[model samples]
Target: MRLDEYVDDIEQDDSVALRKLAEEKSYAVTEYIDDARTRFDETLTDDTLVGSTAPSVFVGRSSYPNVSAGVLAPVGDENDAEAYATTGEWYQQGFSIDDVFERRTGLLNSTRRSNVDVYDVWDGFVGTQREVALADDPVDIELGLDDRPGFDLDGPLEDIAAPRGPRAFAESARVTENPSVPRAIEKTLSDDDWRAEGAITYLYRRGFDVYDINNVLSVGALGEAENRRLVPTRWSITAVDDTVGQYLRGTIRNAPPIDRTLVWHTSYMGNDYWVVAAPGDWEFELLELKAPGSIWNPDPDGQLYMAADNEGYDGRSGYVEETSGAYYAARLGVLEALADRDRQAKVFVVRYATEAYWAPVGVWQIRESVRDAFDGEPAVAETFHDAVRQLVPQLPVSMAALRRKSTMAAGVQADLSAFGAGGDSSRSR
Candidate 1:
């Protein structure tokens, strides 16, 4: 028997084929949809507006700002001319890539496996990373007072946004397309590439007291009275060895100076993507307390190609740099990460500082099409100023195109800071 024949109300009842037939008349549907946005026929399995990859807001874990900007502002407000500002006002929010792109199907997918309660953030994080490792049914991460209604107050990982600069890329505002051109970093990692790191086993081996910490992870005992950091009371250390001891790790007892930190996100709202942390993301004020090379800048002139994967942040001290060579050399390492994944290419660098934060920055692309126009090396830049100096005199340079690089650099900076070792300030802006 035909399924349509079994339906009592064709107008009220919908099906996949029937919905496709309806959407065939897109002109009429657009007019009807304008009357009501969420008017999708529940029964229609294929109800969609051409399946876009545009950005969208997540449920229950969105809109969490009012976060202090940095650990210690290097420059205090105008009133304190001498001392750096201890706190900077931040504004951040996040949007999903699925809601932004209509063609977000097999070609570009926003999907992943996650323990996070919110569907969008999980899918968004997984979509960008391709693969992720979640602890079990329950996710981990800390939270703040501003996270009452819209954030994950019960865990340690409260996905949030970044403060927007004068030129920031928020979620296309309401799902937009670049008519001129679209620039993106192509990413492809298969099972062989993203192997399991055995995070649970690794933790126990390092003397991480999971059984003792679960209590702290449970009801989020670390949650603040008002603006307190969200620390869980007791959480089952997923996949721990059976032969575990009842003793606590020395790090927790402060036997040898140890620090505890959390990782989160903050952003300009709606249109921010994920990234690994970098030294430049650290505030100059906090960096002062630590040694010169304590903070690590991910997008150094050399490590530009490597997409920021995650961060290691602490609520107390700032990020610790990868102690190795000269500061700029380490900076170069970060830039080159994404410099030439497969082939060699020239890159430009640019820094932005307008009564806000300032740091080393860059831009780069392969010299494939230009026919050796740049020769073996197009042009190399270490600082933001040097990068802009080379690209600016291009005569008829696409202003919007250049702007995209700046936005991308900003994203790299934000993500690096979000995941770096310090402040763990990923939840708010």
Candidate 2:
């Protein structure tokens, strides 16, 4: 019987035993919902990346030659063979790793909605800036100290140093001289070690399944001299409570006993979405929700929730929250494409996924506005933006944020100078 109905009966007879059971169930259900709210967001790069750790790159070691100014010299093939493969210009993934559509075919396309999405092929790797002569120096022109007439042998080096002509490692942050290259590299270098993990690989790792790391992640990359490498973005979202963990433990149908506190989340949004190696013929993609707080809960808000296998997409046009029409349109954008493509051609890019979509720290206000607006509607499965317009309406489109109010005019967005809930939304937004 429903808890409400059972409670009514207990009330009519004042039965203590019945009351106890209803109360117990009520707590369980609420806790369940909270845990269920917890979800893993890999598309975070699409909407994450804060601080100076931006995705933008400065020109060579010196600001003199802006890297953005198209200075990559033609990458010569090994041995400079005229008929050999030529390295292409460096570029970002067509889409942010965090993106996906609600309906993902094991082999087709995917989308990332309101949730943070991204992938971590390797962890603890750092974003690098090399100390180079040009890659490191400032862009200012240095007129060679107008020929100081004479050379002095009796003077200190400081008196003879002419502002150190064009610093070899000026614009760069980390530089290693040729003599400094570690005499003995503790590790062997290989493109195979840079393998990218897909949904299948993720599951395999989770299941204690072992495989060759290189075979699964990256294949052979361009020659060692190319100096072309990628610095994967690491993402994390936090929540407000322990309820999220509880919910995660019980939410997924057949999950292992969850013990990780969900303080942050790991994204799956990246160069590719799913893994190809897992043997199981189960359902769609491999998106497991993680809680930096507890592997159980997936809600960034901390209200215990479990969103395993759930996919969220930002619902907005470039910046405006996707109006009902746009929301549905975003969904339809994928669904219509999928429907038209029969069984095999289900995969196609609706919007060419770009690194700009993933790296947001340096975006213009307009760009940020769109990203923020779309975050309001985190559901991607509800395609046809028109169909899901109701998901977000007058729901604090501005930064006032969402809070339960006694009346529409109540201070849902007011400062917590006087409070019912705590200050940080992570605790009770």
Candidate 3:
């Protein structure tokens, strides 16, 4: 399906707004640290901190079984601490990249060294981390840092989990208040025999968002007791997305195909998405065109870096490499819409990353942006080829380049001369 709704194609320059917002917030980094220092003085007694956690946790993958695990707590305001945790709501609130950074930088990651295997113990720092993960809301905690918290904003942003703030070695941590655990999560945790996949799907069915599920799973809170282990935050995010997406795909496997070729378009942050749902059996492909100067492709004069990954009706046999976590993220978006409608389709997603996408904010943006796309009216086309023709000009890369990268687009046997070239067809990096 092609997007011909020229009226809907017009979008405000969110990039300009984001850049301006970044400039305005750039000077606040030092102020943020200074304010945190003041709060530290007021709260810290004998190197111990009395604060509220955002109910956020992080697990690093730098080492094998050995890793850095932490509890994330806001430095300033304790109220509205729940918002500090990662969620789809951030997208709904229309957060800019700078806004994301501001919120993340405000949190102090109080961490300690621990093994990934945390299935039995439930009283120390790791146990407290699990409690925070399982909670329904932010919890007040008493944290003792070995030394003053470290602040360093100069680094590459995380590609999967959202960017983290400063870090500190935690001497001890204890939850001061009872955290309300949802019955579904409580049940899942109680059943040591319940497999992780079933537990995850159950929580999803009970209305727990993926973000919440990811947090819980990352802390080794799920799975069969003996098999449960702490999962790196980055890997867990993709694992949940892929797992949930597979479950969703199953629900629509036998459903009827969409009656018409439908096209939806939406942009968030600096990424543009054109989702095409053509009438056919279940097949999905995600094609990405990264602008030369975009964050992932830094050379201003470099060719656009194009990447793609697809799955047939039976689903993928192995992990996707080209698009990495984004493949699962984008696929989940399409599968969700399909499952909701009780219909399947041959879906193709075109993600164009403009230079305005100056930083990485994680894969949640992809999942949410594509989910939000279905909320708007879709353009209908008589055939799939027509949709591609209409979308050719709006894309950053030429039809030749897209064809080379996209499996679905490559299947089109149309004459190139009739389609007409638009973008540069140079070799993509």
Model 3: residue 129 alpha-carbon error in angstroms: 0.4
Which has the better TM-score: candidate 2, or candidate 3?
Answer: 3
- lDDT, ranked from best to worst: 3, 1, 2
Tens digits of lDDT, candidate 1, 178-294: 222101101101112321123222343454333322222221111222322211111122212111211111112222220211111111111111111222222110000111111
Worst 10 residues of 2 by lDDT: 103-112
lDDT of 2 by residue, 1-429 (tens): 322232233222222332343234324333422322231122112322211111112222222212211111101111221111111110112121111111010000010011111122121111122111112121111111112111121233223211111111112122123212111111112332422222223322243111111111111111132332321111000010111212222233242222211111111121111111111111111111122222123223454211212112211123222121222222322222222322111111111111112222111111122222222212222222211122112111111222221111121234433232222334222
Q: Which stretches of candidate 1 lie over 4 Å from their true place?
A: 1-39, 42-387, 393-429
What is model 3's C-alpha RMSD? 2.6
Measured with C-alpha atoms, the lDDT of residue 118 in candidate 3 is 90
Residue lDDT tens for model 3, 55-101? 69999898869999889998667887888988999999998776787
How many clashes in each structure?
91, 105, 1
Best-fitting candidate, measured by lDDT?
A: 3
